[model samples]
Target: MTDTIRQRAEAALAEVEQVSAVVLAEPTDANAIVPLKDADKPVGAEITKRMAEIDMSDTQSIVSFGSNAQAELQEISQSMLQGVRNKDVGPAGDSLRGIVSTIRGFSVSELDVRRKRSWWETLLGKAAPFAQFTARFETVQNQIDKITEDLLSHEHTLLKDIKSLDILYDKTLNFYDELALYIAAGEEKLSILDETDIPAAEAEVEKAPEGDQVMKAQELRDLRAARDDLERRVHDLKLTRQVTMQSLPSIRLVQENDKSLVTKINSTLVNTVPLWETQLAQAVTIQRSAEAASAVRDANDLTNELLTANAKNLRESNKVIREEMERGVFDIEAVKQANADLIGTIEESLAIADEGKARRAAAEEELKKMEAELRDTLAAAKSRRDGVGDNAGTAVPGA
Candidate 1:
């Protein structure tokens, strides 16, 4: 019976080792690319209205005029200064002087018409408005690019987190599977040791002859000692099983959280980033267009709106990523703790099993010794009784 218990215990331990090996062998890295979904195309109604309100006709007509006026003014001023330096009053000098006067008159006349608008209007809305629009547009574009980069970084981190959770999930499920099998095997062995074999042995010891009551009593004690040791082994196995069962919920909770995190990450990658990209492209187009003052104003407003919305989304997404990362760390630690506890329980169970085997061996050896002593005592008693009977018969009535 002790031998059977020892064998069963060893088998259970082997199962535990096998389960551990499987968990350790699982791959920890993720290899697949996360899929991205297409973003919705931006609406063009506001952009069309703003473009229509902007009258580029006047600006286009004056574009070449401004360039010609500035060029002629520079050339004439240089020529007039050079003539003064040479002190020339001949036909060549007079011709240069007349050309300078005519260019200056043209510039003054053009200035009178162009400068009729207020300085603020020229600076803010009329003079080279596209350049201002471009500057603002590029600024917001840069911001959009930065946000996109941050989102991608967060996406990568989330992927790693998902992989970690996947590994933990697999490991936990495998551990539970192995644990259940080990416990089942252990319970079966305990049943045989406690109910079937040990009881049968005790019954055999109880069937001894009346004259051998003392020997029978000693044998019964040995059987009881072995039975008690086996029961203790069973108790230890059950306790370990209970502890293992208690840890399952924590493991399962981590798995569920991991799934939730993956969904969030997918939403950002597939929908949010693409939508931002579309809006960014639309803003760039508006900034580059040669529209009227009203159109540029509308574009500015639209760009600011998009920038605000995108910034908010990016910030929110980053916050969620950080929170998920923190949770992932906690889940990993929890899994580690659970594994440690299970390993400790199995080790303790193994130790108890070993001790039970030793006790059973001692009981068997002690029982053998008592049986030998009982045989010797009975042999002596038989010899003494036979001698007394023979002597009584030989001496007859005289004795």
Candidate 2:
């Protein structure tokens, strides 16, 4: 039993020593690709099958995620506009009126509600508080609007990324399939060679014996080198697959955030509008009362002056709000550009992976053809030796 185990162990060791592991190097140049013709039949067929299935699923995922994100963005925009009309604007206008009334020494008759005041004039006057506060409100509202648009733009970008991810997933599947076939073929060929065949194989292993041992040694060395190259190529292919998988989720995260932000903007919009509307009404009433009282006191010029000043205030307020909206538009563009860059990067990576697969398939095919040629050459040599031996025996009969 001990001897049997020892013999088995030795046999295993011998087999291990004879079989070399090749480290295939990945192609350094950018043009590598997986050729359909070069891969092992079984491995190639299986890979093709798996890739097709994966692409179909990947396509569905991309479409679903993209559509959902776009829908949520539309909802977010509508929400942002919800309560924007009311909020604190009514109270804010009242606060302005109080300041204006105080500046006129608490006399509604003395204050002009319609004087045409320049921006500088208002800043220098007691109405500065009201103007400043209104300006600030416009700024805040503008910010909210801008951010909402940006989120939508990002949604579009995320959709594009989803498509890119799908493309990359397909390319990766192809590379993985090709690589699997290449390795399987190498291992399969090694498995097919019997122990008895080794001696005969070495005899025709494209090397010298006795006087040219160094040539034989060099041939073995070349085989080892080739094995190392194959290993490296396989490892790099695996790494590329992993990195692409990792980047896919980053896009998904950003998309989720976009959805959440849109929801918040919508809620804020719905609740804030009524407050502003109520305050605006109160401000209009107070302005009218002040105008009537001023006119009754024979302060028609004062009344006109106050009316003009109020008109100037309205114009300034509108300008500030418009500027804020414009800024939001710029933010949207920025988000769109960022999404484009990420998609481009994913496409570039997929292209590189494809090229590597092609190179590997080519090398695997060459190895198989070489092995077949070596087998044929050995068989011919053996046949020729047998024929010579038979002729020698016939000639020796005379001797």
> Evaluated with TM-score, which candidate comes out highest?
2
lDDT of 2 by residue, 1-399 (tens): 123433433343332232212122222323233344555575467435533332212334222321221244335334433533434323323433433343233233323444555787657774533344345444544443444344333333333333443344344444433444443433332233323333444665545656677666655554444444434433554454455345445534543443443333233233333344455456546766765776586676778889999999999999999988878545877899999999999999999999999999999999989967666655555567666444443433222
lDDT of 2 at 27: 24
List TM-scores for all candidates, in order.
0.29, 0.32
Q: Which stretches of model 1 miss by more than 4 angstroms?
A: 1-147, 160-167, 200-260, 280-399
Span of ten consecutive residues with least summed lDDT in model 2: 18-27
**Best by the lDDT measure:** 1
What TM-score would you give candidate 2 relative to the actual structure?
A: 0.32
Clashing pairs in 1: 54-292
**Residue 347 local lDDT, model 1:** 100
